[model samples]
Target: MIEFWISAGLLCLIAMGFLLLPSLRRNRARAEEDRTAVNVALYEERVQALEEQHQAGVLDEPGLQTAQDEAARELLADTDGDAGRQRVRGRVVPMLAAVCVPVLGLLLYAKFGAIGAVEQARTAAEAPGTIEQITARLERAVRERPESSQGWYFLGRTLIAEGRAADAAKAFQRAAETGGRAPAVLGLWAQALYFAGDKQWSPQLDALTDEALAADPSEASTLGLLGIHAFDERRYADAIGFWEKLLAIMPAGEPSRQGIERSIAMAKAQMDQRSNAQDAPTPAKGIRLRVALADALQQQVRPNDAVFVFARAVDGPPMPLAVKRLRVADLPAEVSLSDTDAMMPELTLSAFEKVELVARISRAGDAQHGEWIGREQGAPRAEQALREVVIDALDKGASGNER
Candidate 1:
């Protein structure tokens, strides 16, 4: 937040500085143009007067010569003097302003802002989640209890993990029916619907959320759904209200709190975008996936090492996403997954429809899991899907579905 202000203030100062220098330079140029025109006219008039005097026999050759020399010398002195003075003035102000603007911006940011903390928060936001460990546990849990709705929920989450939006939506639907409509179920359903880009199903999502909200007003998931719906519909005030309610319910440093804060920022940004239609600015639309090793789990590898990161078309053959390989020792304890990573080709919120991410710590070592960081459950849906595939494979092998 503080960084935003500092950046905003710096940008304003830059714009102001640009405006000031150009206007001043224009004024100075106009002044020089005016002076040059006046000086030329004076010289022409003096020469005409000299010609008239000579024609009227009012002056001798020497007098005319002396008058011409005086006029030319005067013109040279005046023009040079004015040019030097304007040059000195013009060069000085812009240079002084250039130095002062950024300095002033720094001082203002230091005195009245939260730039450092905001940057730290932003950095935290960029860190990758420990999804693999969670996915592993969720996978284990669902295997242990195949009939549990918790397992279904976990499976839906894994479908989401694999970027299988449509499948995740179906799984979430099942989870909701089995659990009698949990807030998490409703939230995930709504998110899946939203990501699927089908407006026709939104009314159902809205109804589900209404019921969920009635059951628990402080439910962060439902509140998030409301906020998202409001944001999507351009109801900024409503969205802000919902997000604020969510923030009030959540303690600082919680995931819900951070998510709500991001929503608020995005909501306000959308508001600003609407207000500035003439500007035609576009927000960043990109996604990044980073893979890293846990420090506590690392036996011999350095924490700062780089790791391989890749992505593929969710529905196609495992084509690698464009990225460079870095050693596992180059990255911090947490890796950042973002669009800027070279591995992300055509990165956008909608680009990933279904993808399998594999991160190997080493050829022989166990790869860190994805899909379990914030999600407490393993992917039950994935396990079920795997089972179905296995059965299908067996049936194909047997040439029929008959047991």
Candidate 2:
């Protein structure tokens, strides 16, 4: 910034030189012209007076000639060294203008120029060559602009990449607070917290994921995190469910799609292997329900709209014990929710004595919030069979009002 000002000042001086130099030279030329005119007038008057004196018989031809010679000599003497003696006037205004030009230019620039942006660009151009340098720069930036959510988020991501999970978590938390707890920000914060705790699951992490999903059920980061957690815990079915939802929302040709697909296949394989190894007869400890959209709302929903069928404990946690995702086009479909469909190993449908079954139509594919809903009138036993749920009621506060 100082360098920029110095260069600007030099350029201004050059411009002022261009303006003032010409005016000073013109003033000097005008003064010389004025002195020449006065000398010429004085010579003319002396010659005329000599003619008048000679015509009046006051002097002879020789005397007049000598007088004219004297006049010419006097004129030469008067004009001698006049160029050096004469002072060029009218220079004050030009000098003042020369000084004011730069001052006024600086004032206008201060009012309208983007000096701060210029400095930022200059700083960015000198990119940090190492991770440590980059980290330090980001730290400084966040300190200077604490309200900048993006700055904090990038800093968090950088820290995560550098294997500083605990610091990353703190950065992500700050990002979430400054960013209005946006779904993506919350998801990242939860992920950082999970890794910071050495992959140990906690209620705080769960709450963060829940809040993020409540805002945007299709948030990819939260889904991915949950899937990974389930997979690590050997909850193959739950992992498959979470990964499948994430896969559906991911764009085609995404680089991460292939990995997620591989994960889903592995989870499915694990589930099959476990099922095949079981020797004991598995009793029917599950709920069977048929779900269908109402005839009146058929026009309001699209064929590809998401349909979520789940069971939640009647007097327990708000999260679903078991969940199955379907589409509106597959409505009037029968789904069975059992321990195999549990979202968590300890929170299976059979673990909840009394549960409420619900079917929701979410055009945005959000399981937590939907456009319409239907549920069983009262809490029913987990093994209740062949119940029917109709999607007939408007869902106001879909997840929150489910109690």
Candidate 3:
């Protein structure tokens, strides 16, 4: 607030100074103009006096000649009076001082009055990824650059992440005040409000998502969350529609695609089961096996070095279902696989039957084989199922197929 007042005062001072500038300049020019005109008139009078003396025969030839020479010398002396023009140009100093004073004062005022260094130092004291760190940095960034709506949006998100719901809402409101609503900001702000327990703001989520969809309907996060919301409301058809639309937009094998795939599977299963109860023939439901390596290692589902799961028919393209990466902290004596399903978003195993299955943890950002299963009938029953695949494949000499 103090900074605002100081800036306002400085701006007013600058405005007033500029307003006074042209008047002062015109007055100075007028003074120079009057003096120049007076000097020219005086020179003319002196020449007229000399001419009259010569005409009146006030002196002989030598005297007239001497008088004429004196007049010429006086004319030369008056030439020095033209220095007034230099004085007019010298007005530049005042003009420059007029400009410099306000600007310099602004700089000095900012240096001394604004809390820049203090904010920067405070921001630096915070560590990345920590709530405190994010908060301090966010505050400092907003303070330093209040005009940046993007920065405000980021600060709002940080505030939300830190659980400062009221502050986050205010920050988001300020970001919107900039009259530039980025889709990411709108979506995030809606999420923040949702987390803050304001169901009224829920519609904003749809509005924002719709706006984003207008640009790129395939945006995964937007579609995924909206689909989830629809499914939560028991709107299975709506959920399926959203998921399918998202599926069409997403790349094959993308995590989002997997999620959409699972939702689709679940929705279809529900629909088919409903139809079956109504005396309809049960349609076949395909299986999609997705194995995700989750462990204390690399953190859970980090897509680090954890194994990826893939299942394909003995003679089909290897369909990649899911990638699970672990972190160094996540490594433990045992790795557990949870939430494995044919129709789940993270993995899809039902896509193939009578398949060759492989589970491998690789650091190379892609799935590889650490365990191999031949003719596996169903999803792994336990963590041992994952580990035993290696044993069975080795015992059967199926290891000869690939490393």
Candidate 4:
């Protein structure tokens, strides 16, 4: 900045030099004009003296005429152009200008020029190699001119890039205020405030974002922030709903399209999982398995015995994620355990990373305790081909207790 001012002062001096130097130095044209004026004055004085001498009888008419002719010749020799024309005068104006021009320039700059802005611009041009320096300049600019909403907005963005959400929120707020609560500005301000509060939602932020969306329903940032917040709070349906709205408004080939799509997919999976937990058995969103009694166990199994086909988390509470019931007579049948078939309101196939399938034949028809069971364990996924669960093992206590 100092270097900038130094250069600026030097340039001003150089310009003033150009403007004032010619006035101080004598030029050929002015010298000729001066010489012509001097010669004309001398010629008039000599001609008057010769006429006085002739009138006093000290010189004849011819002498007076000869002296007058000599004076005219001298005048002609000294002058270049018409002798009647007047020469421009007064060094006072140029001298005054030379003396007062720099002062006047300084006064004008003090009144209307942006000294700080000029210095900042000059310094940036001279040394803009670091982000910190650039950011500092931006900060100073916005601070100096609070009404510069665009400048403030960019400063806020830079602050966010610097991971200063708290500071960025302040800048964004200023920008929104200065920028007349513009939709994008307000939405971004809300986002910055949200992060500054450690991702906690506030009524103020909610109001801000709502207002922004009201102004522009297709505002992507507000929708995206809302969706992300919902997803983080496990409100998958709300998350999906918000993201779906954003998706509808997003342009084709949007740079953020993939991220939003992934979020939407995950939210949908969570929503489907929750929905399945509270619904009835349906394979539309579940896994399918074929339960069959082994040929050797066929003779031991009773046709009227209850057969329970279910899926449970591999390492979770001892509750079925989904379950189906049938009779032993229905052996070699395909059964489905899905979100709709969840045994509890909080358990579903999609919620668990892994689950085991079991086909149990219970003589007493108790779900918790079974006589003989066939088991298959792996990741639970909706598959067209049925996974086989054959009842082949003897009940550890069923036959023993019967005996």
Q: Which is the leading candidate under TM-score?
A: 2
Off by over 4 Å in 2: 1-14, 50-82, 85-112, 125-148, 170-180, 200-204, 232-234, 265-403
lDDT of each: 0.62, 0.87, 0.59, 0.80
Off by over 4 Å in 1: 1-146, 198-201, 272-403
Residue-wise lDDT of candidate 4 within 203-305, one digit each (tens)? 9988998898899998988998999899999998889889999999888989998999999999888888888887956434677788888888877878899
Q: How would you order the candidates by TM-score, starting with the best?
A: 2, 4, 3, 1
Q: At residue 134, what lDDT does model 3 achieve?
A: 74
Tens digit per residue, CA lDDT, model 1, 1-403: 6667667877877787777868887879998999888998999999999989988999899999999999999998889988998889888887887778777877987899875556545654654467765555555555555557876797778878877777778778878887888877887887777777653446777787777777777877677767777877889989999999988978776865776788899888988878898577563343333344454445655444334444344544444443334555554323333345443445532345454443333332322322111111112212322210000011111101111
Candidates in order, TM-scores: namely: 0.33, 0.53, 0.36, 0.50
Q: Which pairs clash in the backbone of model 2? A: none
Superposition error at 345 for model 1 (Å): 40
Q: How many clashing residue pairs, candidate 1?
A: 32
Query: What shift in Å separates residue 12 of candidate 1 from its native position after superposition?
Result: 84
Candidate 3 residue lDDT tens string, 32-62 = 6776677667767876787787789876678
Per-residue lDDT of 37-120 in model 2, one digit per residue for the tens? 899799999999999999999989999999999999988877765675654344566678777898899899999998866876
